[model samples]
Target: MDGVNAATTDPLARIAELPGVDEAVAEARTVVDRLLGHRVLRRRSADVSLESALRGAHASAVLDGAEAPLEQVRSGEADDPRVKGALRVSGELGQLVETWPKAPRQALARLHTLAAADGAGADRLGRPRSAAEQAEDPAGLGAPPAPIEVEVRLEALGALLERRSSAPAPVVSAVVHGELMALRPFGWGDGVVARAAERLVLIERGLDPKSLAAPELGHLQRREEYTAGLRAYLTGTPEGVRTWVLHCCAAIADGARDSLATCEALKRG
Candidate 1:
């Protein structure tokens, strides 16, 4: 969080103007709105939110190669360290939501602290990788940025997050997600931290305040597309960025639909 500032230019606003971005965002919003309006939420949002956390953690674990079933996760039978760490991170989101806007770095560190707790040494849990370290390339996205570059970009991103953005929440969240995935700042659990950060943005920015939607599940379902979109984003072209943003929005919509199904099931029984 080195270069944080109260800057005037909204980088995310510019990203929102990219072709088809608005449409995709609008659709995601609509689906989320539908999920929000469900009668189940009015009475049992707490229940839905709890269920969502389980599903989200399970999906995130699967993406990290843990591959636990939802029931296994809920029953506390998924003993993989990655799955357990993901569950830890999911359980902590409510507390971190308030901290995210004020101190994103702290929030991120806490996320990593939880997500990589069992895998990383205690000293390395929240620390970004140094030049001597090699980040895990789970997605096989070539080499991660150098330690210096990761630091600079993270500082700039922190600066951006400290202020209000004219861009939609979807755009901001997508950028945060893509950038972290691309940066791989920490040596372990960077992907889990990145996606959790995106969830915080979507929560803080009013898109899905209760965290009912499991966008991680959407990403899990569309694994190939998610990877391709992230790869496109890493290319640093307008087309690539737009592709990633659209893909993220689609995943969000899919998450909303999944939540809506959850609502239906809860309503029936």
Candidate 2:
């Protein structure tokens, strides 16, 4: 992921300074510093990574409408296909984030493969859905863009990511997640995959370099609001976009605190 951080020109510089976003970005930086400043977490890196993966998978699965107990999901006793797919993608995030910034298409394909392989069928993994195969977004926002639209938008998104905008990583990441969710390009499992991609931005951008935060958990904790935030992003208005960005910042800050909780849990155990 080091390649993803080449300190390029900040493509998102202007957007970061927009109305409500500056405040959100500032608070996000504070939350990030607070998380990274934890001495106990530095000493327990492995446990932090493990808990992040576990909680992230659990929370993402719930957002996809497959709520399951943490222990059951952890033990592989959760028989739901959605949960199973989210688990696979979340577990593989460490390897995936490394590829995301440098070769976004390749990275995104790999993510779709993992999230869709079990549930969507082995044959369909790693590709967009056919017009015949495209379905309603799991988030129930609307019917997906046509296959051609998906292709065009996806190409644009890949370019945006590869350019590695200097926008605050969290802000860039929120846009990435939003675009993915909006495009719903894949044949299956985009919600979980989108969150994983967002996490990759945070990881590679050094906002949460230890990979110990599960912002997905924050979304799950505020499911209705989270869904509304995404809906607002779909509106494409400036205010709507700012609402989404601020919502994402709050989730990320909550995720930082989630890491603190993981630190407490690991300390106790």
Candidate 3:
């Protein structure tokens, strides 16, 4: 949302030069093919809920660990509120994935407003105090901190989406993730909002997010590795960020491939 200035440099080409990136991409492509097939089968099934279908496909093959069964989620028997919340968020996210792109910033702002009203979780969109308030001398700190940075960021995101021909998927992804994480603009459910925003971006680009898979699920799967990668990325090293991005891309491809395979099997049956 900042501006083109806030837009980070695309690292795909640089990442491509890294060792094993190509191989990773190839493996990812294969996995995506299979996931796509499974999605087809689920689509063919009249009784399958879209949320359940994606959760199952993502959990088993694309995610790092064993997925919770679809029946278990639908049964609403989980004692843990977090698990229930996760499932509910996942379903809402799936629905958003099916919808086309909306104004990212405005949507986020509205979500924050709703979150604040309902005491959902976090209130990220609160106003910032003027610099005068920060300093003893009124004008020394310069103009007051505007309350509209969030709106500005949202507008910037919309602009980015409008003129995205030059940006690669990973770069777009990075920007989106960085903004949501940095802003934390909602009163609650920041994590879910961030993930939902990512899915929305993918869907807007005509990418099948349902097939692309959830990186959080993957992060959860390989917890140590995932945390290490995130730490590396955050520590001014690009290696971990590159690793995480490629891992996500690979998961997307793998999930799609698995979905495709399931669809084929269902068809044969």
Who wins the lDDT comparison?
1
After superposition, the stretches of candidate 3 with alpha carbons farther than 4 Å from their true spots are 1-23, 37-72, 79-85, 94-102, 109-159, 165-171, 209-216, 257-269
What order do you get sorting by lDDT, best first?
1, 2, 3
- lDDT (Cα, tens digit) per residue for candidate 2, span 150-201: 8998888888788777689878988888888888878578898889889889
Q: Which is better, 1 or 2, measured by lDDT?
A: 1
For this target, which candidate reaches the highest TM-score against the unseen true structure? 1
What TM-score, computed on C-alpha atoms, does each candidate reach?
A: 0.95, 0.92, 0.59
lDDT for model 2: 0.81
The alpha-carbon lDDT assigned to residue 128 of candidate 3 equals 21
Error of 1 at 160 (Å): 1.0
What is candidate 1's lDDT per residue for 7-105, written digit by digit as tens?
A: 226778778878999999999999999999999988999998988888888888888778777898899998888899988998999899889999998
Query: Candidate 3, TM-score vs. the true structure?
Result: 0.59
Residue 84 in candidate 2, Cα distance off native in Å: 1.7
Each candidate's clash count: 0, 0, 35
Ten contiguous residues with the weakest lDDT in model 3: 135-144
Worst 10 residues of 1 by lDDT: 1-10
Q: Which is the better candidate, 1 or 3, if ranked by lDDT?
A: 1
